[model samples]
Target: MTNTNRASIKIGGGVNGSKVEGGKIRTEKSTSSTENNVDIIIDKDVTNSAEIIGGEIHVSSDLKAEIQELLNELAKNPITRKEAVAIEVIKEHINDNPSLKQRLLSALKAGGTEALKAIFNHPVVSVSVETVKGFLEAS
Candidate 1:
């Protein structure tokens, strides 16, 4: 002979639902008493990433000469479409930021090497480098 206790415990609740034996269940979500009353803290890096490149350079003279030769080469020949697109993207970025323009002017006044260094690893510079390299290898 076997005996089975046939009991079904149906625990069904939505959101913050609860069940109890002859007790109240919220069945609703509770919101914070203090809504929209909060403070947000933000820590921003004000230092320019451009400065990092200049900090790493030990021989400015050699860098300046290399930059000058690159410019001379570009000036002496017609640029490929890839190079033109890269330059356009860079120009748009510089035009959008007045502070960048001022910083660029200052760097140029100090020396072309400093100016070159400022944008050394920038997205625009990366694009330009890859585009130029691709063109050179193709020719």
Candidate 2:
């Protein structure tokens, strides 16, 4: 039911010893393949489960101020976590190409946190952020 490789994760109706090239049966897994790869999936009948939460504004009042402060600081900084290896990759790209760094910063300023988080899971761009804000509406 879980794939620890992080290369891909799958939650099949039934568990298999190993994963193959990926056949049918509605995979609930995380795949890093940019070409039609998978990140998160649910096999339940529920449809239209995607939702978004505007940063800082989507959290509870009790934790709102703290989360906002965190967001403001992180929005203009570098990351430092082994799990966030993607950031290293991004840093490399930015080092080699400062223009890209500017471009991404510009995009972030324009799109705000929501878009940046989406880009992380998205293939075309690779940027991830913490302090996730769950959608106000149910997914």
Candidate 3:
């Protein structure tokens, strides 16, 4: 005597993604996997939506010059240790995206509170927003 039997199982798919909107990020993630001889099929759809949120950091030319000077001073002042670390963090993130860095530079040049606020919202620079603002606004 001999017997044969089969089993079938179904699975749903998943999706993962991130979005930045109005200086904020909305993220979602879903995943599924199967093991053994069993066949698992999962279907998922992901959508990411975002609008560049940033404005000029409004600063006078003199203030901008001072900010530049302060940036140069980062290496000299031990008191700026936190600021230095934040700068490093921002640098590493920016290095991964040249265009983003350029955009940041342009924003800085334009000078507006919005620009500064936008930079503050960036994940890499979030922690250093105040430090960055201080450097840019310090007289």
Q: Pick the candidate with the highest lDDT.
A: 3
Error of 1 at 70 (Å): 20
What digit string (tens of lDDT, one per residue) describes model 2 on residues 1-139?
Answer: 3222122334444323423232111112233211212233334332244331222111122222322333444444445223255455444544565554454454344434433343334222233454221211111
Instruction: Report lDDT (CA) for all predictions.
Output: 0.33, 0.34, 0.39
Worst 10-residue stretch by lDDT in candidate 2? 52-61
**Residues 8-110, model 1: lDDT tens digits:** 2233332122222211111111231111111222233323321211111122333334333444444454452245654664455555666654554443444
Per-residue C-alpha lDDT of model 3 across residues 1-139, encoded as one tens digit per residue: 2111222233354434433222211111123111112223335554444222322123233332333444545545555435567577455555565665555556555533344443343222224555544544442
Better of 1 and 2 by lDDT: 2
Angstrom error at residue 4, model 1: 85
Candidate 2 to native Cα RMSD, angstroms = 16.4
Between candidates 2 and 3, the one scoring higher on TM-score is 2
Better of 1 and 3 by lDDT: 3
Ranking by TM-score: 2, 1, 3
lDDT for model 3, on a 0 to 1 scale?
A: 0.39
Superposing all C-alpha atoms, what RMSD in Å does each candidate have to the true structure? 28.1, 16.4, 19.4
Model 3 ranges with Cα > 4 A deviation = 1-87, 122-126, 130-139
Off by over 4 Å in 2: 1-82, 122-127, 130-139
